[model samples]
Target: MSTVALVTGATQGLGLALVEGLAQRLEPEDTVYLTGRDLDRVGAAVAAMPAGGAQVRGELLDVADPTAAERLAAQLKSRHGGVDVVFGNAVMRVGPDDDPRRIVRDYVEVNNFGTTRLLRAFAPILRDNARLIIVASSLGTLHHLAPSLHDRFDGPGSLDDLDHQVARWRDAVADGSARSGDWPGFVNIPSKIAQVAAVRILAADRRESDSARGILLAAVCPGMINTPTSALWWNVSDAPTPAQAANGLVDLALGPVDPAHYGELVRGGKVLPWSPASGRATVVPYAATTASS
Candidate 1:
């Protein structure tokens, strides 16, 4: 059987490292696609990777574009028949904002809604037992929210439900009515939370149907990486470099699926346990704001 995998937003940082790691593991006939928004960046990323027997290719795939995913899916379907693994790593993390409201909305559109769009477009093309991993954060753990809001997030909710949650956040941030603990004031936290929620819902649905596909869906929080993006919010002296972090992600992308870990937030190859009292996953830097990979 041939191996086919994809990593989105792979022009730099963790995404780039993932592509390189996958390339090392795959055989010559297998293919690993490194995708990003810019063709130039994508080409550069692909060129930089050492050929580890896999066919490393570059493609332009902006998750924010509603149609781009479908177009790529159709193309890949025609050639490879199905996708064995997919790593969603795109984000719209704002530094400083001109219009706070617009920034929040755009952030949701790119970071939250963008994930849903890829799942919708790719669902039809996933091979049996495929791995679908969204690079999320530890902040997604429900303990971060108030007790009243846990049901909306931890329960079975469709993409529409997720959108409703996103809208609620956008409106609240816009109107300056967002409470501190009720919803994280920082937009990245909520966006990552939405991503984790999406994987949980999807994994549950796959289980309910008993499709026998054995798909593994997870929103993974790769522990804080030593990168420029992380430099802004963290002291990265001990943080793993992007290459080191990619090792875990590549394992998830190609390793055996743990039934207990299905539909859960994962880190370091283990299911991230939720403690309402804690409200975040257990990590050295429990509150990481690093965007993208």
Candidate 2:
């Protein structure tokens, strides 16, 4: 059977680099699906890839749209039977001036909820030993949150618990109490934290369903890369190139499933400690700001 891989948000940056890296590693009979929100961008990305051994195809996917995700899953099932690897690389950033409620809702919709949607749509069809790589961020580390929040995220919680925790954060942001409640007013970090927590929950669920499949699910931080998105938040002139950062993501997706890496947050190909003890020594509190009516 030919190996099949799917990469989300593959139009450019780390996502595109991951697609190129996966293509180079795949066999001639293998296939890599490059997906993005825009058909033209996806098509252009596919066209730009070197005609390597693997067959590259473009597909339009808007992770925030559940219907789009479901449609893609159905198509993948019909054409490939199952997927061997999935790189959940799509992400959104919130601006300082954006409404707190909108920030939280939009980020959760795409980064956290959208990720779960994909996992749900593909879980049944993922091949045994399939790899699910979530492109997370170090900014989402537990160290940034209060000890109480850390416990809730790292503790043994069901998927429902995770959802409830995220929903509470959303409510806090909407009510203008996020800063006082220790919830980050911005979405980037909190969304990534939720993504990591969700991965842990999903891994446990997957294991209960089939322990022997060796299905590896992990969230990884591709150290600060000079992507357009990063440029919006920070000066990236000194940051690593997208290809350099993508190396770890591609490795985690295609490399052997190190039992240690399962359900862990990896960076620079190393698993960082996720426990409360490993959290940063100082927690920066979010400043209180009134949301515009």
Runs in model 1 with CA error above 4 Å?
Answer: 96-102, 179-181, 208-211, 274-293
Query: Tens digits of per-residue lDDT for model 1 on 112-216?
Result: 878988887787788988988899998887656555567666764687787787788788877656643355555666667788988877767777442377778
Backbone N/Cα/C clashes per model: 3, 1
Q: Across residues 1-293, which tens digit of lDDT does each residue of candidate 2 receive?
A: 89999999889888899899899989989999999999999988998999766889999999999688888989999998989999998877665467776567777778877887777777778898798888888866776666777766777467677777777777788777776676654566567878888888888777655357877888888888896666766798999898888877887887778887888788877887665565453465566332333
On the 0 to 100 scale, the lDDT of residue 285 in model 2 is: 54
lDDT, each prediction: 0.79, 0.79
Best by lDDT: 2
What local lDDT does model 2 show for residue 160?
A: 71
Global Cα RMSD, each model: 4.1, 2.6
Cα misplacement distance, residue 270 of candidate 2 (Å):
1.8
Evaluated against the true structure, the overall lDDT of model 1 is 0.79
